[model samples]
Target: MEDRLLDKIAEPFNLQLPEYETLEAMIDGILPAVARFSEPNLLPEDSPLYVNSWVRMTDRPGATEVVMYRFQGYQQGEIRVVTDGEIGSKAYEVEESGDRIIVGESIMRDSFLYELSFIDDDFLILRRHGNLANIPHPYLFFCREAIGTRLTWNEALERLVDKYRNSQFPLLAVGLFVAAMIALLIYFR
Candidate 1:
C-alpha cells in the first residue's frame, strides 16, 4: 500500500508511539529518513528547504539494510523507486556514554553521531559531527521530515524548516523585529 493508505490505518488508531526512550529504540527499524537537509552549500539556518526522499530500511535478526530509495523531484507522485536487492544488511549497534549515544553499523561503517540539536517522535535529525557522508550534504548530517501524502513544491520547502527549527527561533525572530521597530521609532522621534 502507498503511504497514505498505510497512514490511514495507523492514524485512526491514534497510535502515537511512546516518547523516545533510548538510543537502541532509535535504531529498532522504526524511524526512516523521510526528509533530508537540502544540498546547497549553506548553513542549516540559511537552508531554503529540506528534500523529500522515501527511504525503505528493513531489519533482520542481526542486521539492517537500506533496501529501497527514491527522490522527490526525480519521481513525483506515486512510488517509483530504485530497489537494491544486493545492498545487504549490516550489523548495527547503539552505544551510550553519559548523554552521548553513538550509533551505526556494528563496525561503524556509514555511522553518525546522535544529533544534539533536536529529537522527537516526529523527527530524527543526525549530524556527522563535521565529518562528511559518502554523499556529503551541506549540513553534514541533516534534518528530516515526512508525511503520508505527496506535497506541493511550496509545502516541501516549509516542512523541513518547520521540523528542524528550534522552538525559540521563530519567537526570537519576531522579538527581534519588534525591538528593531521600536528602536527605529525612538530614533526618529
Candidate 2:
C-alpha cells in the first residue's frame, strides 16, 4: 500500500527510488543531506515560493528511529518574510515505515507524499505532493548552503512572532508596551 502511494507521488516527476536492500539504509543515506528549494518556481505564482528543509535523526521510543524535520518556506509578501527575512516553518516528526518515510502525528494530516528524487553529501532533491491537488510541483531541489547550522523550533516560532509584531504592526506593539509600562507605574503608585 505504501509502495503504491510512493509510486503515485513520484509519477509526476518521473523518478524512481534508488535501489537499497533495506529502508534503514535508504534513510541513513539521505538524512545527512540538507535538502533546500530556493529558486522561484512556476507553481504558486501568486506567492513568492521557496523551501528550506533538513532532517535530524533521533533515537526515540515507539519507533525504530525518529526524524525531526524542519521545512520553512516563504510565500512572497508573507508579512514576516518580507520585513525580517525570517519565514515560519512546518516541523515534522518522521519515521520509516516500509518503503515510505512516514511523517508522524501532527496538527497536519498524517498522509502526505514524500519521495527522494536525489540525495548526496551536499545536495538533496525531493518531491512533496499533498491532498491539495490544486498546487503543482511540490518538488524541491536544495543545496547545503541553505541549511542552518543549529536553528531550534522555539527560536523559529519566536523569530516569526517577533518579525510579524515589529514589521506588520510596529506601532501597535510599541503602544501596547508603553501602555503596560504606564499601568505598572500607576499600580506601584
Each candidate's lDDT (Cα)? 0.35, 0.36
TM-score of each: 0.30, 0.27
Candidate 2, residues 50-124, lDDT tens digits: the string is 233343322223333223233333221111111123344343322333112323243255535555544433333
**TM accuracy, model 2:** 0.27
Collision pairs in model 2: 36-142, 48-76
C-alpha lDDT of candidate 1 relative to the true structure: 0.35
Give RMSD to native, each candidate: 18.9, 21.6
Model 2: per-residue Cα lDDT at residue 145 = 31
lDDT of 1 at 110: 61
Model 2 root-mean-square deviation: 21.6
Over 113-187, each residue of candidate 1 has an lDDT whose tens digit, in order, gives 543333333223344355334523312122232441234222322343444443424766656765786687689
